[model samples]
Every structure is written in structure tokens, then in C-alpha cells.
Target chain A: MNVKAMQKKWLELGVEVEETEYAKTGYDFSLTLPAEKVHALAEVMLADGFYLVFVTAVHALPAIEVVYQFALASSPRCRVMARTAVRADGTVPTISDIYQGANWHEREARDFYGVVFAGHPNLVPLILAEEDVDLKPLLKEEKNLKDISALRHLPAEAEPKEEKAPAAAKKEPAATDKKAAKPQASN
Target chain B: MNVDVIEDERQHQFVLNMGPQHPSTHGVLRVLLKMEGEYVLDPQPVLGYVHRCHEKIGEYKPARAFMPNTARMDYLGALIYNQGYAMLLERAAGIEVPRRAEYIRVITSELNRIQSHLLWYGAYLLDLGAFTPIMYAFDDREHILDTLEDICGSRLTYCYCRVGGVCKDIDDKFIERTRAFIERLRGRLPMYEKLVNGNIIVQKRMKSVGNYTPELCARYGVTGPLLRAAGVEYDLRKAEPYSVYSEFDFEVPTEQQGDAWAAFNVRYREIEQSLRIVEQALDKLPEGEVMEAKVPKKLRLPQGDYNCSVEAPRGELSYYLVSDGSDIPYRIKVRTPSYSNLSVVPEVCKGMMIADVVTSMGALDLVIPEIDR
Candidate 1:
């Protein structure tokens, strides 16, 4: 579809596309949306015969943003880009169902930026080991990271109602005591 | 209804892990093969052995300083990756490349691509149990490396490309050598065809094996030989026309079968096309300044994110750079093609024999560090 037609189609899908650009900078066109709406936007891209090239994130201080770049293999072959502002530890629904290529792309994004894909079947570390999932190598600046704890957004710890103090502090240590007691890999 | 979940499909009886230490030029990738006797039920790729955190490093360094580092990603086609980054920064900053450098870039990179395919033809055949062809392939490829090394000052990991243009200009000696080498390699193709293309053993191993339709390749974002073999003529150099690629004339070869043999044929034909491109580029190599003068030492991109893609040897190598209008880029994402191409293994390997897994893997022409990075 032409850019005007595509923009109209996106509007039809309830996507408020930011703008249409024919080869502006690196992307052909770009759309900015909230984190929850990325999956909806991706469906339009998939239906329009776009290929999911890569899913990545940029840690831009106040907000961490995820970028999904797509290329239309159909005639004209215009490139499309989508950017969404994700909260630290924000979850974007998986597109692996639509494009199997997104599975590893999402994993690499999560491994580097700690932005979770809510429904990825096996959301383990891809380039990083399971234990080093939290390090998030790409989050670091020259001297130190801009932020770490907030990188992988988790639910803000509930006010410890006395007895639940230590359990609320960590992800799964005290909660999954049975599995923690079993074993660990030799480092 | 979804793939990978396999609702009522049979479960795999055994799991086999092959290589983080593979002898192929495609670096440290471990494939977990779930097998039932001699057939592969599922093939899962486990990566991240050599993640250098190159993007993180990009954020810490100046844009110009990061040019050389791109070569480390796809070592086999370092020059191609180098051009993609250099041209990206140039486009962002509105820097113009001299016409002469544009011709030179096309010539050298095309040579690098031919050398890369030669290595793949040899290495892939080696994996499929043929050793004699590699000797001829490498012997021809050695001349390309030597020629590039003379002009660029490096062999494998070329840090030759700079922001506005390449680091050095080629003399007539370089031009004469490239033309001679092209003719020599052209003469070698028929012998390669006789030994491998027409051989019954190769046909037994390759024909109708590890097949992927054009639709399957497009679904998983596969490019280069894999896509061409599946009968799509979607070459970025032809479709999008970057650099001097438009000025030169060549064909985008395609095969209808979408099998391993088709992919092999695509790569072989591509070598001939690239040779034609180099000859045309050499014939049209212009005379002018090779570098854009007075380029700013400290580069600052206008605050925006842009993407650029090149037809690399393996597939489409794209660079997505997001700049915060600072000397250091905010993010530099390489959309390396192997990552997507290899992702299709699980989909394609669903019911193939165990040993055919090697044949399929060989056909993908994966370079592991590209995927891992």
C-alpha cells in the first residue's frame, strides 16, 4: 500500500501513527505508541506483508523505549519503524505468534534492556546466561549505569506487612524456597 | 494453532547439543538437536557465547571511533558492514562521498563479497563431506585477501572504511590485479560445477533437502541466497539501489526449488554476478578526490533515529542508529540477517533426519558472532 493508504489503514486499526516519512533518516515511516498497544500495531504491519527485522530498545534516561523495525517486501518495499515508551520492566505482548523471527529478536532485547515480552514461551536469557539476566550490559553509561533496579520493571514491593519483609524484597528466593533448596549450576 | 507449541505433535525422545566449538567460520553457536532415532524432531539454537556488548561500547565512544568496531560483527564481510556504518554516519551528517570513492567502495566490497561466497562454497562443501573443492576455492580467495590487504592494510577484520569515504585510494596496480583475479576466478567456476554441482554424491545430499518456500523465507525475514533460492529477486542493491550499485548492471539470480541445492546454486551464480559488478565498477572508476574535505572530527547527529541497510554477503545488514545530538550515539542496533535466517531452523527442522541437520545448517551460511552480537 502507498504511504497515505497505509496511514489510513493504521488509523482504521486505532493506531495514532506519529508521522509518515518516505526514507527520512533511516526509517521509511515511524509510529510512537504506549507499550500495551505495540502488539495491536504489529498486527497491522504483519497483515500488510511487513517482515519483523529486529526488536531493540534505547535507554533514553527518563524513559526506556523499544524500537521494532519492519521492512515491506512487497512492491515499493518501504521500511517502517515503531517506537513505544515502556516503563522500567514494562511488558509488550509477543508477536512470535505472527512472526516466528520475533522470538529471538525479543529475547535479545530483553537480555540487553530487561524489557520483558509478556507472553514469550521461553523467556530465558539469549546472549546472557540465566544468572546474568539482570546485568543488562547495554544499560551502562561510561562511569556507571543510569539505573539498574528499575531496568527490569517489577511490581513495586508492597509495604512489608511485618512478616512478609524479606520475601517481598527479592523476585523468587523466599517464594520458591523448594526449588531454591534443590541445586544450582557450578559457576 | 501457533508454531513451537506443537499441540498434538509427538515429543522428542533425545536431545543432542552440537558445538560452541564448531570448526566452521560461522562462530560459536550451539544447536540443541532433539532427535527420535536418526531423525531430528526439533532443532533449537542457543547463542551468546561471544557477546562483546558492542552496542554498549558504541554509547561510550565517539561515532568516528566506532567505525572500525563494526567489522568485528561480521568478520567474513567486514568491509560491507564497515560501509554500512560509514554511509549511515555520512547520511546523518549530510556529508557527501566523492564520486571516485563511491566507485571504489562498490568495487572493493563486491570483491569482499565474492571472497566471502568462495569461502562459503568451500566451507559448506567441507561440512557436506567434500574436501578437494576447498583447496581450489581458498587458492582463488587468497588473491582477493592479498589484493584488499594491499589497499586497506588489514586482511580478515578490515577497519578500512572511514566516515566520508574509504581510508585509502587504490592505485592502477590494484585495478590491474582485481581485473586479472576476476578473469582467473571466472575460469574456475566450471571446474567447481563439475566437481560439486554435477556430482551424484552432492545431489544425493542436497537435492530436495532443507527446503523453504519464498513464503516461508519472507515469513521469517530471510534474505540473500536463502531468499533468492526461494525464487524472489528482492536484492536490496537492485530493489533499493544503494551507492554505485545502480550505475552497474547485473542480474539477481533465482531458483524455483527452494532447496539446499538451489541455495548453493544461488551463491554460485551470485559470485559470477559480483564479478561482473567489480569489472563494471573498475571500468567506470572515476577520477576525483577520494575523501570529503574538512569533515568534522567530532560528529554530532541531528537528534533523531534512522536506519540503513546493505546487501551483505550473508544477507541484509542494517544499522539502526539513535542519536541524542551528542558525540556519543544513544543506541546503535545492528539488524544482522543471520539472526532471523537461523531462527527458521526450528520451523524447517521439524521432521528432518539428524545428519541432514548439518546440511541445512551449512545452507544457512550463518556467522555466529553476527547473531550473538
Candidate 2:
């Protein structure tokens, strides 16, 4: 399978980024989406033979950024990061039913960041005790927020805007533009 | 001696707990076993016994300060963890690592893989009721550890890898000793084959004991030997080709049978392949500074996210770092391989004899600390 060609499909589906920042940063490809579309994206990725590497959440305050690392186990590596934001309800649709491996990763994300996966077979706390679930060990206070990219003395890439407060980066609902640009008969 | 009492006893279902207090389960792990007579119906793993707040520490400390802590996550394969975190920071920050530094990283990390496999072999045998092989395995492991001790000083949980390069250079003595150790172990390989692998008892016990198919591997997100044992030739060394791995020519050993026996053979063959990588690295050992120049004492990755993955001894050891433009990271997630490898227990270990559960778990070669972290 042509691993690189899959990005065009994702773009056609409307998850748009001009190109992955892998050469600039380390991630191969990053698709930032809302919680609702993530499960559908996972279904598409899984059908394409991509395996779920990890599911983790980065607390950027007000909202939590959930990152899913998926990789294809075929020739020509195609690694992509599927990210989405979640708020107070902390619920994202579960893909554990599709990929059995997501079962523990989703639980671990919940254990640390309290970003719950809706319809997860078992959403119990993992790697932490039951009482400590409310602590949400990974959430940092505002005063302690330090820009590690600056401290390390390295150049930073443009970050995707937090969904709750969006400004830069191409706006979503971008599928039609890419689709229209392609030959209409190809559909 | 009433027949009614016997009937009641026979029909009763029971639950057994294995080691939150520790033994046989590997590290401080606990398994909640549901059983019907002598057969296990389900095995639920309870983690967090050794959770040392690793992610919290990563966020609180500067990137360089957190180097030593990476070694703490997967103590058995500390160098791989060190390599993963260091590489993650380097990639995120666009730090250029020297060619020599990359070669050094590969050599040391491969050595770590062999040492890890040695212990896994011995421990697996021990789990299968053979105690003698461990003594023999450790005897060989001690030699490699001694050679590693000469370079980094610590025999285990090495804190030697830095962001752009290793913490220290490999001395001539360390190189000579490692070469000699490799030859010594190579000569001793057949003896191990005879003593452990060739033994009739081992073959009978391991073969067809716990079948994990390729489809099963995908569903469970199993990687490394477990995936390879099921005949999927996807070693990160070959597949992703990070660092200087692509430069090395080696075969990924795979097995058609997805059972404990296949895992045993794959891991054994992997040790030889690791030895080959060590040899190639030694021959091509370049002359240059070990540390990358202009690397600041403190490391702050740019305000973005980065992921670095290394094929650790057990499976993929991935580190994800999210920076908030501060000295401390916003979030740091350590994706240990054992967590996913061990998670398949409740599914596959179910409906097997309790003794076979031990066999299957041993085949997984899990380091409990890795899972807990």
C-alpha cells in the first residue's frame, strides 16, 4: 500500500493541514480535530491497516488535547498523530471496540488527565489508585507553566490553536475545497 | 465425607490473587485470577505498585535533568529509554547529533537489548519450572554487564545518553572488552542451545502452549517478539529505521507459530543479531567527540509536540513530549511496551490452565516496572 497517499484521503475527508511538520518537528503527520469526528477518523485509519500506538492527553488548560499515535505496519512507514480537544465533559468516543489495544491506553489517558473515552468497555483508572483518579496528576498549575521549547534553546513550530480559542491554522470544514480542486469525476 | 459436600466443593468457582506483595508475577505486579478448578477463566492485571510519578517528574524537571529519570522507567532496558527520551528532545529541538554519536548510541543500546533478553530467557525458564538455566544465563549476562560497567560505571539502569549524544565516550578498554565478550558469548551460544533450547522438556512445554496469532497481535497492539512470533516481520529496527539502524545489515528473526516456543526462538536469535550489530558498530566506530557541541545544559523543546520511539528489548518504547514554551514540559507521556503486551492477558490467558498462564506471561518477557510506569 502507498502509505503517503493516505494523507490525500484524510484531506479529502476534510482534516486539513498543508503538510505534516515531521521534518520541522518529530511527528510524522498531525490531524487536529474535535472529539466528535475522532471515532470516525479512527474507524477509517483502522480500516486502512493502521495500528494504534498510543492514546495520551496533553493538558493545555481549559481544554485537554488528546493525542493518538497510529502507525501502519506495512512497507513505507506512515505514522500519524490524530489529536482532538475535550472539555469538562471529558468524553471522546471510544475506538477500543474497533482496536482492542486502545482499551488500556484510553484508560491510562483517563487515569492521568480525566479525558474520558465514551463507550470504553472498562474506563477504570490504570497505573493509579481509585482515590487518586480525581487528582489528575498531569494537570499543572498556571504559575508552573514553563515553555520547555524556549528553555531547551530550540526553535519552535507553529502550534495548532486550542479549539476553545481558535485563531490561526487553517479553519476546519476544509474538505470541500480540497475535494473541489480534484477532478470532480474521480468521485 | 458426605457426597453432598463433595458436590458443592466441586461446583464452586474461586478467585485467586497473585502477588501485590510479590513473587512469580515479575516485579510488584498483581494478577487477579478467576478459576474453575485447575483452569483459569480470566486473569486481570492490577498495576500502579511502582508508579513513581514519572510523567510528573518529566514535566517538573528540565529536559537534561530528566535524563536520569528516563533510565528509571524501564530499568531492565535503561539505555533504550535513555535513547528514546534523548532522541525525542533532539528531534523536537532540531538538535543535530553527530554520526559518531549515533553509532555509539546504537552499540550501547543493542548491548542493553542482549542483556535484557538474557534475563528474559532465564526468567522464562524459571517460570516453566527450570531453575538451572537462570544461573547459566546470568553467568553470561554478568560478562556483558561488566563490559558495560567499564563505560558508564553502573551495571544496570544506565544514565549515560544525553540529548545530542552520549554522556561519555567509549574508552579503548571498553571497546576491547566488549569485543572479547562478544566472541566469548558467541562461542558459548551452542552450549546454551544444547542446555536450554535443545532440551526436550522445554520444547514440549513451550510448543503450542499459548497460541497468539498475527490477527490477535494486531487487535491487541502487540509488537516486538510477540508480533514476530506470529510471523509478522515488523521490527522497528527494520521498519522505521531510526538512528543508524538502517545502516546495519541484519535479519529480523520471525516464527510461523504464534506460541511460547516461537517467542523463545525469536528472542534467542535476536541476541545473535544484536551481537552482529555490536560487531558492525565496533568496526565502524568513528573518531569524534561523544557530546554534541553547543548543547545548553538546560533543554526546552519548542512549543509543540514530539514523539520518539525505540524498539526496546520487550517492544516499542515511545516517549511523547508536549512543550509549553517553558523550561518544564507541559506534559510528558512514557508509552511503555509492557503495558500493552500485558494487557492481552484477560483475553488470551482466559480458559487456559493456571500453569499455562505463567508460561504465556513469561513468553511476554514483561518487566513489571515498565508496565507500571
Candidate 3:
């Protein structure tokens, strides 16, 4: 379907959409929806047999814009992007109910940008270490260092470090008394 | 000894740690399998041993710099990943590639598909307890690698394709060599059928095992040979033509049964179809500049989101790139086929023996790096 028909259908469904800008290279439509209607919009799209390609969040200054990209399975080329911005403080409704593929993508977004997806079954860290340490790797270098230090100041008891020998040390040969003496003799 | 054995027998299920290094697991994938006798009760796959955070690295690097890393994700189908990423950018930036460049892209991509299938054939035979087919398949794959290296200047991790077009042009000698190679491969395929495909041992191991119906295949988003094996006449090239594929004539091979044997047959038939595509692309190759002249040194795509899907050897590989009118992409999401294909393993392996899991996974052509990335 063309952009005009898509917008008209979306309007008929009681979902408000505004065409913010036109992109030359990719899909034509840039839609903005109310935060409360995000999940409903995704459900409607899913019922229409649209496939959820991915969910990504861009860190704008005042708000974190979470964009859910979809396309019809029959017409895979026609792309549609639905975006809704949550406050920088982080609160957004989850769409895992609508699309099963969104489960992992939501977890990834949460771990990286700290965007809390409400009602997500599992929001645990997908890639990062258990302890938070500047999860935003793309942040400015100086600010990242500051975030790292701030993370380091958390009470040690809050997050217990696993007690295991370092990987390199685990591979070291056992130090016998004879080997120690031989090392000294060589020196 | 009998008393001690009796005392220790509480009799739950044994947990077997398959590999961080086992050969059959393929590429450092470790699976914790809960076994009840010889059958798997449940299996949990643990990754990240080889994960270098490719997405994070791509985020830091410039758009052009990430082209080489595309090959690293699915080492077997490197050209498809390269094409998918490059095409997404090319479409976004509105860079027009010459006809000659598009033909070369098709030729190399088809060659890469053959190489990938050869590797899969070898690996699948190995999974079924035969070792000779692997050696035979590798011998054929070496020829493809040699041909690609001669033109692209690299063998395994080929960064040959560029944003608008391929990195280099092919000469008459390269074309002649590819034609000779295809002819040679056609002669050897009968030998492959005799040694592996027609063998009774392989048939016993693969036929009627790990059956995935067409409905289940669609539900799981399985594509490429696996979906075709399930009787779905869906190929991205024929369904939604891109990169001058519509110019070529080829058939989408499908099989009746979605069993391991059917998957193998679909891939085998696909190799023949790919050979036909390569021949057509070579004959119809337009003589012109290999790389487009108008493509920019620094690509700044307009602010928008683009999704591009290509038929990788394994399945349909999709790349979603969002640009904010900057040289660097705002968000890049790769929906690799292996992720969905691998997700269906626990379902397929539910009532099968431990050995069937290996064979089924091999037939599915599970590329762990692609999945983990």
C-alpha cells in the first residue's frame, strides 16, 4: 500500500499519525503516535500480518525516541516506521504481547539505553555484565568515563563479584618449589 | 563398588556440557543438554564465548568501515551479508550502480551461495557419521575460494563489494575461469550424489527425521532452503526481485517433505539453479565501469529508516538501518536468519535421539556467529 492509504487507514482506526518528514533513500513515512496507543498500534499492525523487523531507540537530547519498524510479509519492500518518544527518565509500554520477535530486541534496548519496557516478561541484561558500568558505549568518551566511575562507587555489597580466578591465571602452570629454584638459578 | 553405586543413585537426568570446543557443535557453541538416557530432556544453548560485540563495534566505526565486518558474521555466506548491508546504504543514499557492476555482484553472490552449500553438504554428511563427503566438498569449495581471491584480493573474509558497486572489475580470464569451474563442478556433482546422496547410511540417518511442516516453517520464519524443503514456493529473488535478479531466469526448488532428507534435496537442487543464474549473469554481463562514479566518499544518508532483505545461503537475512542525516547510522539492527532457525531447534528435537539433534542442526545450517551477532 502507498503512504497516503496507510495514513488514511491508521486515522480510521482512531490512531493519530502525523507525517513529520520525508526520507529520500528509505521509506517515505515518519509517523508519531501517542505513548498510550503504542501497543495498540503494534497489535493492529500485527493483525494485518505485518512483520516486526526491529525495535531501536535513538537518544535525542530531551527524550529517548523508541522506533518500532514493521513491514508487510507479503510486500517486504514497503517499510513503515512507528515512533514514540519516552521521557529521558525511561518509561515505555512493551510490545512483546503483539510481536514475539520484540522480546529480545526490547531486552537489548533496555540493557543499552536503560529504557524500561513495562510488562516485559524478562528485562534482564542480554549482553552486558551483571554490574552496570556505562552501558551506553556510544556516549562521548569523557562522559562515559564519568559514568564508569559513578558506577564504580556503588556499594560493593549491592552487586557481589563472582569469586573465580582470572582466565589467564587459571591457565598458568603450577609453581613447584623446584621450578621456583630453577627460575632463580636462571636469573 | 556395587554398594557405592547404589548409594549414589538418586536418578534424575544427567546434564551434559557439549562444547566450547567440540567439532560437531561448530564454532565454539556450547549447549547444556539435559539428557534422559539417550534422549534430550531439554537443551539450553549458551553463547558469547566468541561474541566480540559486533554491533557495538559497528556503532563506533564509520559506515564504510563496517563492510568487512559483515563477512565475519556469517563466514559461509559473507557475500550476502556484504550485499545486504551495502544495498541498504546504496538505496538510502540513492547511489546508482552500473549494469556491469550489478551483473558482477550477481555472479559473485551466486558463487558464494554455491560455496556455502558445499560447506553445508560436507558438514551435514559429517553430522551423519560420514567423513569422505566433507573432503570431497572441501576440494570443490577450494576452487570457489581461489576464483574469488584472484579477483577480490582476499580469500575468506572478502570485503570485495562497495556501497555503490563491487571493489574491482573482472577480466575475460576471470570470466573464462569461472565458466570452466562451473563446468568442472557439473561433472563432479554426479560423484557427490554417488558417494553421499545415494548412500544407504546417509538415507537412514536423514530420511523421515526432523520433519518440519509448512505451517510450522512459516510460523518460525524459516526461509531459504529449509522453508523451501517444507514446500513453500517463496524465494526472495523470485518473490521480490532486487539487484537485477529479475533479469535472470531460474527456478525456486522445493521439496514435498520437510524432513532432513528433503532439506538436503532442496539445497542440492538449488546449487544447480544457482549455476544456471551464474551462467545467465555472465552471458548478459554489460561492459561498463565496475564501480559507480557518482557515489560519495562520505555517505550521509537522509534521516529515515530502511530495511533490506537478501536471500543468504542459510535463509532470508534482513538488515534494518536507521540514519539521522549523519555519516554514522543512528541505529543498525541485523535480523539474521540463523536466530529464528536456531530458535526452532528445541521444538524439532523434542522427541528425537541425541544424534538426530546434530544432524537436524547441520541440515538447518546453523551459523552460530551469525546468530550470536
Cα lDDT of model 1 by residue, A21-58, tens digit: 43447666666566667778777777777777788887
Q: Fraction of native Cα contacts kept in each candidate?
A: 0.50, 0.52, 0.19
| Residue A73 accuracy (lDDT) in model 2 | 68
- List the candidate numbers ranked by TM-score, top first: 2, 1, 3
Better of 2 and 3 by DockQ: 2
Tell me the spans in candidate 2 whose CA falls farther than 4 Å from its real position. Answer: A144-187, B1-11
**TM values, all candidates:** 0.89, 0.90, 0.81
Question: Which residue pairs in candidate 1 collide?
Answer: A26-B306, A26-B307, A88-A153, A89-A153
Cα lDDT of model 1 overall?
A: 0.78
In candidate 1 the C-alpha lDDT for residue A75 amounts to 46
Worst lDDT 10-window in candidate 2 chain A: A178-187
C-alpha RMSD for every candidate: 8.9, 7.3, 13.6
lDDT of 3 by residue, B1-373 (tens): 0011121256666888888786777887777777777777676665556666677676666677889889999998888788888888887777888889889989999999999999988887887778888998999999999999999887777888899899899988889989998999999999988888888888888887777765455445567788788887778787668799999989999898888899999999899999999999999989889898888888877544566778899888877765545577655767788776765665677656778777777888888888777
Q: What are the runs in model 1 whose C-alpha is more than 4 Å off?
A: A18-24, A87-89, A140-187, B1-12
Chain B TM, per prediction: 0.96, 0.96, 0.95
TM-score of 3: 0.81
Cα lDDT for residue B132, candidate 1 = 89
